[model samples]
Target chain A: MASVLASAHPQETVYGQVGDATVPLRFSSLDEEYKVLRERAAVLDLGGHGLIEITGPDAVAFAQRVLARDVEYLTSDRCMMTLLLDADGQVVDQVLAFGREDGILLESSCGAGARLLAHLRANNDEGVEIADRSGDLTVLGLEGPYAWGVVGRLIDGELASLPFESVVDTTWNGADIVFARTGFTGEYGYQMIVPIEHAADLWRQSLEHAQAAGQEALELAMLEVRQPIPRHEVTEGATVVEIGANWLVDVTKDEFVGREAVLAAFEAGGGRRTVGFSGGDGVPAPGTRVWVNGQDIGEVVHAVHSVGLGATLGLARVDHDLAAAGLELTVGGTEVTTLTSPYIVPKSWSIPII
Target chain B: MTIDELRARAAERQQTCSQIKKMIVSRLDLEIDPDWITDDQPLFGRGLELDSLDVLELYVAIEAEFGVALYDSEMAVFGSVSRLAEEVNPALRA
Candidate 1:
């Protein structure tokens, strides 16, 4: 699946294959685009993310059973980020679930749509209607400390300050769209779910106010904020506890698809836990060994040269007792220091929406 | 540091983080177990999803529990349970 706005993108845009979709990796240089995303606003072509709709008499019931969070009373004005866990408590995808009048709409993480769609269908014992809406509907995003200003110029200023995860059905340039105050990079972010026909136009108009950022820059920002990247963080046999994504799972909910397994893992405890580290010279591979004074504890989950920190940043899943921040750990041949979450404090944390 | 010494240091920080997590869960009336909260997991806006009111409650709770006043601290101090550990137990900042 290619982005619907690919034609509107500059000819020099770099594209990469991520899972089942061929998507833009960067519109410009990674450093440049990442700077734009953190300092100002950057437009995003999120069409690579799959949108699946669930509607039927048993729609809410089906969603309740599959979603990791409790969404029993989710109204049309709200949306949430939750994990789609398999029966074994492994994450299938991290999704943005929107409450709709009919039932619900799920936006899968980039390029994981096909897998998420298959999972939804296979688990459709309730016989709810599952429609893949990616063909007609696509998503665009604005993110940065000043992204709210872009929303004011492109859409409505009032929509810019809507509480986090607030969704509204609105019109943009005579096209009906679903606008939501959703963020991935911890910036003041908003997503516009527009029709594929009008997507190019919206993308072009957005480029006037914000530079286009692609998957590489977006994912980098997400990593700095310790956001869970399903593809990189969810290793084989790793439970939700090891992924440090317990916040996404509503353990209070009685009977969701992976609830029992997740709770058991939490109760059983003493598994490997993920922690952030920065100091290595080069970007280490996913399976790089993490060491403590020559004793191998675990391996790296994912890593990259972080534009925000100007250093190599990575997540290491180590023995549970060794996962806290501020410890000195070794990866490959270099010494690294374990760090706290949000390695780079988002400029939006200081900048207000107004 | 030797492996055993590093483990001891990590345990100290983890213990502080656990206490902070218990304070957050109890002060905010969250239902999840205190141990469920990871040291590096975020505490505001995304991970724990604590709001401004929850922040106020935590501010009061921290000063009462740890005898440390965070009234003048920046929002980043509450970035995570581990980050908060550094704040309440400054020894962990080493």
Candidate 2:
């Protein structure tokens, strides 16, 4: 409805760069990347994140017991989203888990590595050891259009079949790296972690490699760091399902922590939901309230200025009755209608690029 | 916002002073008598160990009776039923 109205606060986060490495933290640069990302494609260099390696005879069993998702079935080329929960079923942390020939590696929200390693150690039994590989590894992202092609050409073995959630073990650029097909852009992307010394070298190689491939080369562009505000949002644990990622939850995933509580809450019948809204053609900030027929039903979780679709689109968790795409909502005291259609893809891009 | 009104709303949600007290006891793993929770003692206080998140659960429970708007104020106060009555009844009346 409204344009990116000049907000009181400008999103001016810093971008760190060294010789050739950079982490785009500012919204302007990030936004430019998002634009390039939609039109052609771009590979961003994410340097601050780290990694953890879980190894031992009982690594899978140990991880499954402590993690909210079952990791026993994890193979060399697949990744799983699991929550590391305290006994109270409250989140200790959220992690992206994967397994390969050598060990089960977990990359998490940065703050989780030490706490998770200690948790396993305190409760560890036979044949389990955890190591913080954050110092040992370097992370790289092959995002944008030629991401898969560049990676696909270098690595062998069914790389093309890797889906949004697939993780594979492969030797690329003469070193071992865990390739997880996932990213934050809601597109086809991959996040690769390898030896630290090779990090800068691989980054320079990948960029050099992408430009030579004839597609719009990945470049240094900024994107807005907008989280879906995680449905859990710390304060509203289990309160997130109704809004941000309802599709991500598998109510059928056997018994798990907070499963019963979420189901109980579901039965009791009031979980906030994410709906879509637009003010003629303006974007609303995430967490803006949604009102309908004099009732406060939900809030916005994702918003985008769609250049492709030519309209402002958003994802909000709203009242069940008002969930239909055409329903109207009052956000920040402004009236707008919720629409389910997205500004970009006909399908959602939830997994990271591998 | 009155104690009676809140109690009535909680009652509609099938919650009572005893039930609320029992929940507070069990949820926090405390052993105090359910009766130790008084209508006037602050839901959170110098004597109470409940944190901000516990207050959120309490607010969610109370929302079943009065709408959540009762807590949306400039000062953001919601401590006890009686105090809540003093705080919200005026706003409702105004």
What tens digits encode model 2's per-residue C-alpha lDDT throughout A86-106?
544455555678776666887
For model 1, how does the per-residue alpha-carbon lDDT over B2-93 read when each residue is reduced to its tens digit?
Answer: 88888899999999988998888898888988987877777877888889999899989999999999998888888888888998999988
Question: Compared to the true structure, candidate 1 yields what TM-score?
Answer: 0.99
Considering every candidate listed, which one attains the maximal TM-score?
1
DockQ for model 1 equals 0.79
A1-354, model 1: which lDDT tens digit per residue?
888888999999999988888899998799999999999999999988999999999999999999999888889999999999989988999999999999999999999999999999999999999999999999999999999999999999999999989999999999999999999998988999999999999999998898999999999999998989888898899999999999899998999999999999999989799999999779999999998777999999999999889999999999988888888989999999999887999989888776
RMSD of each: 0.8, 16.4
lDDT of model 1, residue B50: 87
Model 2 regions more than 4 Å off = A1-13, A16-23, A26-28, A86-93, A110-127, A152-158, A161-164, A183-186, A211-235, A238-240, A243-253, A280-287, A301-313, A346-354, B1-94
Candidate 1 segments exceeding 4 Å error: none
Candidate 2 vs. truth: CA RMSD? Answer: 16.4
